[model samples]
Target: METLRNWSSLCGYFVFIFLTTVSKDACFSEGSACEAPTSPECFTKNAIETVYNCEWSMNRTDGIVTFDLYFNSKTKFEVFNKTWHTIPEEKLIQRREVFIWVEAHVGNSSCSSPRRSVVLRDIVKYDAPQITSMSWSNSSLSLMWEAPEKHPALTEVWLRGDGHPAELRKETFTRINTDQVTVANLSQHSTHWVQIRQRSTQVKSPLWSNWSPWVKVPAELAHAPEVNVTTKRLNGTREVTLTWKLRSHAAAAAAGVTYQLSDTQSSLGCPCARTEKRRHYLF
Candidate 1:
């Protein structure tokens, strides 16, 4: 009875070992005898039955990288060439660290050798900023913009305003850190063309994004319009022709000024008497 119990225990131990070995083998079978090449240096080069070279490219719009594998033979090429997973949207925008790997199958069979992992780390580029709102008042222009999707290590903005009369003046503000800027001392009653651009310090290279389209801002706010009114009697009618001239066309248009006319009644006792009749006209 003692010998039989010992034999049973030994058999159970052997069964456990066999099961573990089978599980590991099953996992290792996928990339059996397959290894990565060293040309790119992003992946590991190993001594195995088959070797492959890998190449990758970034898709800025989709925010993903497509990896392709080149094998010596057609059979290996068909099995290992596949796109990796799509990069996370937040990770791409934030320019965070990312890792990628691929499994190369050594033989024709899908499961053959242990899978080898390769990794690459990169910093994604950020998109350009966009202007959201703008306003001008009292010869001052205020602009607001939306920052890039990815938070840049350091952001620099550029603003430019071109005044009318070509030679009058051109103003530019550079290396501004904030998303909003107010430009003062602009010429009133004139149209000013404005544009903006931005760059990020997170990137290794020094590159500025494309400038935003030009926008026009008429500097006519806070200034009262100067208007001259004159009246002349017609040949033989009670109607009188009134003509007016505005010193500043831009200011008058922006202010939406309106004119009102009233005729006063004259009497013996009262030299001038106010009349209830009045006419309003928009200029």
Candidate 2:
């Protein structure tokens, strides 16, 4: 009888603890608004808005993490619309980088405390930049990612690829709309994998940090795409209807018939030249 009573009490205590933990998590944002640094009114009364979400690794060996939230603006303060997750380093495949970014939409006003951007990758915990978008054009690959979590500040970005003697492409970010970095004049008809890296070290070799995923790009000098021609006899004489397949969308989709072929090639830059796109016709 005594043991049963003790067990019941322990169960009740555990329930209380679980509820307490959940309640605390639910109240962190509200408490931050009431506490310090964060002005709850940044969403309503000011032109400058601030938003922040933090993610951390309990084990140092874990990989870096990304806390994602649908963002329409660069920075903003909201009652809700925040999320977080941590990724251990072990989960990362090959040699790639993981980034964390927070955006803000300019409020009607400014913040009371001007927050400075910090290097979050090992240098500063919870201080990673935002990845806006990634793409490539011909030999030049471009990266447009968000900058600074809070107040306006100067920033820089770099890129890594398998070019001869692999080098880093750097660019500086000022009070700008976005962070843009492009490494151009690359070889054409060739595909190279790339990743994005950044450093806020104004005007110096701050640090050629690690790279993100390998974003591939076509070779520089862009080959005139590729052309594959085919013809068919008009069910009779030499009156053959000719149609050539080219590497252009307009060429593929002409008249009313759309012709598209997926080549089973190693993409374009795939090391295996055996890679190819299958041909298709819709007349």
lDDT of candidates 1 onward, in order: 0.41, 0.35
Which candidate has the highest TM-score of all? 1
Q: Write the per-residue lDDT of candidate 1 for residues 165-204, one digit (tens) a residue.
A: 3443444454344476677776665566666665555433
Candidate 2 local distance difference test against the native: 0.35
Worst 10 residues of 1 by lDDT: 40-49
Q: 35-83, model 2: which lDDT tens digit per residue?
A: 1122111010111222322421111112222222212224332322223
Best by lDDT: 1
Decoy 2 TM-score against native: 0.29
Distance from true position, residue 96, model 1, in Å? 15
Quote each prediction's TM-score: 0.31, 0.29
